[model samples]
Target: MKKLAVIAVLILLAMPSNGLFNFHRKAIHFNVSHEKYVPPFLFWRWNERNVVIEYFDIVRNNDSIAANITAYLAIPPSLPNQEIMDIEFEPEPDKILEDEYGQKVACYKLKLAPNESLEIGWRIQAKIYNIRYILLPFLVGDYIPPDIKEKYTRDGEMYKIHDPYIQQIVRSIAANETNLLIKAIKLHDYVIRHLSYALDNKWDDAPTVLKRGNGSCSEYCFAYIALCRAAGIPAKYKGGTYLAELPPYNDSIFHRMVLIYLPNYGWIPVDMTFDEWIFHHYAFGFHSNRFFALMTGGGASQYLNWTYNSHYESVAKLDIDSTARWLEWK
Candidate 1:
């Protein structure tokens, strides 16, 4: 396996090639499992029951298969009598599977939410054999952070003695002399070196992870997003499952990673979970279509663009049916 530092150097060296920036199509198949509950047509309850709803699954055949899948369990407030109870989205799963030669092919299942506390079960499957090639350009974009962003930025300054590691990662990318791939590798290496995988620690913002240097998939993602943005590179936080031989709950199991858009190569997946896995493929040598892409972008508050939530019990809840209302409202 290539060291994270080595990969960063190579990525830096490979920049400035117009031919390198192009999208390759892929074929994909995915299955999501979660629990969902619909209030009995006429039941009037004071609190909302937890329900897990699945979203985003569409498969189109071309040069490669591409699909984005996500699910949320939330409470909905309806009428004068409905109240939401404790709602939680736990054990979220993310994965992607590709054919041996990078051809789109696969059979896989990813757990989007835990079954133990879910009221509804959800799944999405897609297969695409033909895909087209396209170029991904570097476009400057702005992301309006949710309420959480302000909190984390403040916490980062007040709680930590100036994160030297964060500064290092930002400097590497901002130098801008290196290629996009190199910038990405440096950012990925930084996270793998500084952050420890802690699936149990639920992180709602970036500062919490920066302060602890330990967190679940969300924390890792937040760090990556923060670093990339600091470098003036446009990056997005992606969540989904990876199809591997390991069990889903194993500390060794890999969940989600950040995918950055390369000027030429559209969206490329990066797995800080196993920096070695990325290095093995991007550097050392190991290739397999065992991963899949799910949801992309950060602070899932944007999901509210399509989803709505009401307090069911003192916990977070979502009412997917209101998605129509969002569209109509827009």
Candidate 2:
């Protein structure tokens, strides 16, 4: 009887409890580096112009990883009476590293373009170190509450709970018969119009922006994410490097931008502050090519959180491709 009781206790201990006892943690290390080599070119005052950009990137990691990288460039549009040029994509060299597990880690290389043919001259080389950990908390649905359990049953109001801003936005949309795309556009526009871009201010938190109505690129992104998530739009935060044209005497370092996930388009880059600044000031229209995006979302306690560091040194080399030609519009 005693032997049987001991065996039963051991079996009970082996079994997972509410799916929480079966969870595991994983550790990964990753590194990404970029370099650009651009040949000098002249700019002409035509309705449309064609230019080719070239880029090279190298990434290294101790483990396998998967991530998305975005490269932005200003391309001339093809419109009525506009000349269009075909953009080309060329392959670049990729470097790989192996781990002790003897498993070949995954690596991804992508060339994100503004349009299909107009390939921006940029290369994003990524190295990923991934380890799969079984999370027991998901087995018995221990992570979710009983009330919220029924909410996830369907994709309606029950599932979309506790977001005041989203509720308000949805109400407005329903009243006006507006679609989701239009709502996102209008919401972004509203954010841009209401907020001002001021790099001098140091606050990058969402609550700070909500109270002060001012923030930097991160704040802009946080505010945007909060509003989007509140609307049940499934939004996330993206932080990475950007290339911006610096003035001759200006010593500003690093550029930042925001990316939101669109249902049909996956992730789309939006530079609300840049667009607003250009629309209002017109003096700064060009972004740098050496800016490299590093991380996404806010919970980056493990990796280096570049967005929070106001004085982080930039590893970008800016070379002026053309002479300054300021345009004045009424």
Candidate 3:
């Protein structure tokens, strides 16, 4: 983590290409300095709730030969806005490992004979809070640390930040905006205005989604993230389950949201899909207290990578029965 030394100012400079004789002027220039005016408050009063995430997973072998199975499950992580109260696992996993993206995953190993099954269940108690930041346009950090910029701004398979189409869109939408916060807001709103919620079997990247003009929730996030990155803003995805009902709920649907790195504010949550359901409002710096985050800082594959494999020539199947409910609320 990079630390500031006594209110230091960082400037972003674009270097020239090869050839010493031909010097090029910097195309991108920005400065990070102290805010001119201080607001009464920077963050709004947060609303909180307590909930429990419970799930059961079953892996079965249908072959005539014995086989070994390995599985990975995401552990509910603690964030600045969300806390993990407690966790209970039935037949505990073998080990817990952190993935490259910083998501905690519980690894389970099982050996089953022919026509046998293994069951893994767990319950996680968490306290989640709604995040609402009163962001000032100038106060939003224009300078992203080199490490974060490198990690988050890179174009991915589904995050086509470098695509000409995406770059063109971002330049048109936010090219003239000097304020990082406003630029990010413009990109976020553009995604919402252009893309309508629609179910699609194929997962499309930013350019594809933008061209279609409509996509699923994850597509909305992909498009927004790509635009933000192209505009020199650091952004990533976070996946989790949305706690929307009382206990005894059973549904396989999962939700994903974008996390944009704001200089002084840190990573802020943005959920356009959830916001659209609520009368098409802007959810740039606000998140409902109903999320059970599983992974952060990666594309959709980070969460969907869970699998069951076997060495023998045997067929295996996975089934999950999951439910989340309010444990305590105020």
* TM-score of every model versus the real structure: 0.43, 0.39, 0.78
lDDT of 1 by residue, 34-88 (tens): 2122111111111112222222222221212222224332222221111123222
Cα distance off (Å), candidate 3, residue 304: 5.8
Name the candidate that leads on TM-score.
Answer: 3
Misplaced by over 4 Å in model 3 are 1-41, 62-67, 112-115, 279-281, 300-330
Residues 1-330 of candidate 3 have per-residue lDDT tens digits of: 021211111110111122112234111123334534344444432445777667666666676777767666777779866889898877898987766667777777778887677777677787877555555555665566788888888878888788899989988998988777777777877888888899865678889998999887778888988898889888988877776665555535677789998876778788888667754334656666766676675553343442111111224543334443335444
Which TM-score value belongs to model 3? 0.78
lDDT: the better of candidates 1 and 2: 1
Q: Rank the candidates by TM-score, best first.
A: 3, 1, 2
Task: Report how far off residue 147 is in candidate 3 (Å).
Answer: 1.3
Candidate 1 TM-score, C-alpha based: 0.43
Clashes of each: 46, 17, 0
lDDT of 2 at 217: 74
Off by over 4 Å in 2: 1-178, 246-252, 280-291, 305-330
Residue 188 displacement (Å), model 2: 0.4
* Rank ordering of all candidates by lDDT, starting from the highest: 3, 1, 2
Mind giving the per-residue lDDT tens digits that candidate 2 earns over 118-215? Answer: 12223223211111111111111112233322321222221232345445654554335334334445566666777886676464555456457777
